[model samples]
Target: MIPTNIVVHQHSKVLELSYDGGAIYKLPFELLRVLSPSAEVQGHGPGQETLQTGKRDVVISSLEPVGHYALKPTFSDGHDSGLYSWDFLYFVCENQEQLWKEHLDKLALAGLDRDAPMTTKGHSCGSH
Candidate 1:
């Protein structure tokens, strides 16, 4: 297994997630929504992932720790389904540059930017 570590560097308007295994993911609330690991984003299975779009300035409103292995994140737009587990977090970190690049690629494919329009709907975007 690959090594991993997660650190939350909350910003004034953005929430930064750092990994010790190499890779720093600066996840804004909106980006987090689109990248949510829930069915909305992850979809039913492989090749069914719904690419997240139109999120640039998304900021995490809350970061609640579920025990010690996962996180229950609540975004400003009210989307949470991505229970960021330590293992998952480490995975993201280990592949930060690649994942972020893919994220940007998808954003570009959707004609979205880093500061897109904000939505009003809010819901659980994470797991227990």
Candidate 2:
């Protein structure tokens, strides 16, 4: 049987979820984003995942529950894709530590930092 409780430790970056099957899981924020199902990050086809960088300090501003088994997460960066399903949330929470480490490794190999400065384009950025 799965448990039925969902809790988040924002400061520690931990997301605790309980399933109705007597199972509980705790996941990290970074891991969740890295494994987001959004097209911009996951791509439109196989072997086409776009790495998300400069999100180290990103936090979950809001977690709006969508229906009874999904979530609409609003991040501090204003990116709100990647609807998290029940199974997906369970997966992440179950394997948080390892997944987080892997993300760190990937960032290191790519030589990118979540806090790195990125030049914004468009008229809003002022002058070309």
Q: What lDDT score belongs to each candidate, Candidate 1 first?
A: 0.62, 0.71
Q: Show where candidate 1 strays beyond 4 Å.
A: 1-31, 110-128
* Candidate 1 lDDT over residue span 1-128, tens digit each: 32243344456454456545555555445545666777766867687676665555566777888876777787756677778776775565456667778888876887876466644344333532
Per-structure clash totals for the candidates: 14, 11
Q: After superposing candidate 2, which stretches have Cα over 4 Å from the reference?
A: 1-3, 20-23, 114-128
Candidate 1 least-lDDT 10 residues: 119-128
Task: Please provide TM-scores, in order, for all candidate models, with all chains considered together.
Answer: 0.64, 0.73
Top model number, TM-score? 2
Per-residue lDDT tens digits for candidate 2, residues 1-128, read 22388777889886777776677677666667667877757777786667677666667888888777688787777778888887777667777777777877877887877556533422221232
Error of 1 at 68 (Å): 3.0
